[model samples]
Target: MTRRPRNSAPEPPAHFAAADLPVRDCVELAAGLASYARRYGLAHVEVSGPPELGELIEEFGLDEVHFVDSHRRPAVDIEATPRTWRCGQRGLRCLSDQLIDAAHAPPGRVATASTLAEGTVLRFTRHNRLGDALGIVTGLEHYCRDNAVASVAVTGSPALAEVVEVFACERVRYAPLSDRAVSGDAIFARSSWSLPWLDRFHHSVSDTYGGRVRHCVTPLLLRQEPERPEREDVVYCQFDARSGTALPLRSARRLLSQVAAHGDVHVLGGPDTQYYLGHDVTYVRAELPEMVARLLSCRLFIGCDSGLGHLAGCLAVPGLIVSTDDFETTWSFFRNYASLSVIPLAAAELLLS
Candidate 1:
């Protein structure tokens, strides 16, 4: 349900306080945020989320919502469009570490790393994956606000744009993921890889709402696959280094083999992934929808803490997330899932059991 915004003056935007509001379901969360903003007695609640979230805010009468279209990495000229930029992959020598630290840094300390030239803007675009780009955007949002930099410009795919638009950026530009060379001054690209967005989103659904978001919006976002008699005892699995570093081949095989002992297990991976995994286990290659279908029909899912792992949890499928060394706290907060730093045969056996 949408929370209609008050006709009165808006409340000052507080990302942290809004994050603490207890609500789920994108629409409800948006309304609650609007209410929170109003309670604070400020005008114009600054909000962001996945791009599609703009509609929800509009439905609630938050017309001036800062819908930041991040996700796209199209080639654009920042000189002419001074207010817009990208979050895609860009190599920054000395500024990368400082920028990442700044996303979580307090308002007072974020301006210490000012690599951008005067009158230039920072844009976020592609890192290795869309998730990576978003993580950088979260940090950049905080940094820009703290540094008194105007809104950031982000460009990418429509789907990515939908997600990024909900983020706290000033403006957004949409374009396909491209290899086009980005050239401009004061343009810092998203380089560091981490999914900080999950944490930021989670806090918004805390308090009164249940901590797990798997219930509020997962069903709407993903269609439930009908049960298959033939797939009754199968376990769906995914293991690849598509976004982050790959889990070791031997570790994955050992875990999968143990899981297979419980019953039939189906492995999911891309073309290159299948080679290292070998043919001993049943391998199924499919696009995202098919992959979702497989997970829905399976007894359980096992995979690294990548995009698929997040999806499995959101779908409320019982699963295990293999956490790598650089595991972020955000990745562990999911419904119906357990995480292990290393592959544990016992964990697999328990999940399948």
Candidate 2:
């Protein structure tokens, strides 16, 4: 049996903050609610799985609610995988697991078209995470185009602005993000999506203090400009991530080296260009603009799960993302799917086919 120090205080179970979440993130939001229950002396989470898995979670006092048995997936397209969990289905699965404790405990704020006014200018007040910003802007871009709505965004990021500049309709404007009153009568909207696991995270902040999740269909608008006909066969790779969520550098280098044997490899961020000096690769000290240019020119982008990969998706750049869990598939995997645990190079090879 596990033991604590004789005079030690009893430690409460670990938890997550589940506020406004995208349907895909319902999985994490579910578990977070469970955590809340345990801490408050409500019901402890009841879980079902193999005995070995049960024992593992018993140690953490959790049910291990995440993508399990992913390694068993046939080394190919995710569609071939039997799990029908993606997007809203993740919400259903989490619900089936009885993760949400209170009945509609957290009031959800979903900004569907019914909630937004037409032809009135709306400005979002919150700005964080290039990835979520990308998803939000992409949704807004399409929303404005389809409905002829005038919308605005408040962000300090020129890189994000560049994305809006490239895709958003003329009716949408990029207002500055900080240190000023929100000009005009601004109705708010927020980007809602799932959490990355462990120390891994990309925020899903709302425009309000705890924002509302806006719903809109985000399209792949990467129809190339004829003037940009000279697209090159370069594969872009990035080993960087926020929240310590990136692949180890040595593993990254090895993967890139293999990808390089097929064609030219462009590394996005790493310690130094000198580190991979001998490899058939070009290491770029990437800025948003530079990254955009490279993304536009390359045949594909490959990287650990990160926001830049989301940026690539925003620009309609095809990407292959290596992630620890299937959470991203529920929201964003950029059309390329690969698994972890079995070492993603094997998964990548299947995605390649």
Candidate 3:
């Protein structure tokens, strides 16, 4: 993605002053909306995850909040029954509820492509890549014009922001992080599709932290672990990249072996290691709280600069993020609560120290 020239003297709006909070999964987006709403005195806010809203409520002291389950409507009828609940299906429902709420809830000035109204809608981008960035901007333009959004705040890549301005919106604001401070105790690392780079980065971090680091992933892996014989010293978790095509499975296997050789290795998402030397690793699938507890208990967090890294940051855990240099310049891990060290692909091995 080409970098757009920074607009040094973009005209500031005179009378623009309403807050539209659209909830998404990204912590930065959530924090941005919360800040916007509090600053502007918004009466109603809509978001995807209820848990995220809980965080907002705690921060902002929400007095008039409504819970809209955009994902799953708890089946009261099935609550008493002993049937297994499909978590992924439930997650889908939560996403659906959020989308529906945004679509039907009063058509506020804030808008997404699917939900827009006349006024200024803050459209947030979902991914870090270029194509998705363009799509988000294009979608926001359509959504703003249809919903009467006078302007749009294009939040995401700098490249996408440039494309959004061409559509003649009222204004665009950038919320880039200027300074970040990572905790010395926490060292974060992860496996990217770039295998050689990930291996080198993993080693660097292990060396730096004296081979003491906690790997964090989603709670899905722990959910599958056996309940009996509860292990406390080293929590087992799995890293599931099954749904996505970009995950470096081969690199992950190699990194896993390196982790095991140095210290106790806990898998947080998946159990497959056939791609790299067929090494067997211990794993446990548990609830999100369990995963969170495990993460908070650790001093240093090492993972790919993905959602797990964000989660650790959200919990105020110090982290060392291993990512592409370009990736750090565009998308950062630190928001309001946590900070990280952005190590480029070339310097990943430095993280092991």
Q: Quick one: how many clashes does candidate 1 have?
A: 28
Question: What is the Cα-based lDDT of residue 185 in candidate 2?
Answer: 14
For model 2, residues 1-353, the per-residue Cα lDDT tens digits are 87877666433332222233332333333343333443345444333323443333332234333323333322211121124334424322233223232232332332323323443333333334566446555555554455445564545456456656655345456665444424221111111222221101111222222223334244435323324546888888776734245665566666776788789877776555335343456777765655667787888787666667666655667666666445344234344222212225456655444
Candidate 1 weakest lDDT stretch, 10 residues: 77-86
44-148 per-residue lDDT for model 1 (tens digits): 445445444565565334543344444233311112211111122111211222222333422221111332222333222323243433433443344444345
User: How many collisions per candidate?
Assistant: 28, 1, 51
For residue 328, model 2's alpha carbon misses the true position, in angstroms, by 6.0
Off by over 4 Å in 2: 1-114, 117-127, 145-148, 177-216, 220-226, 241-244, 270-281, 286-290, 315-319, 327-345, 349-353
| Best candidate (score: TM-score) | 2
Candidate 2 local accuracy as lDDT?
A: 0.45
Candidate 2's TM-score: 0.52
Model 1, TM vs. native: 0.43
Preferred candidate (TM-score higher): 1 or 2: 2
Residue 32, model 3: Cα distance from true site in angstroms: 18
Query: What does candidate 3's lDDT look like per residue over 148-230, in tens digits?
Result: 44664544456445444332333333344222322111111111211222122232232222322222211111223223333
Q: Rate the local accuracy (lDDT) of all candidates.
A: 0.43, 0.45, 0.37
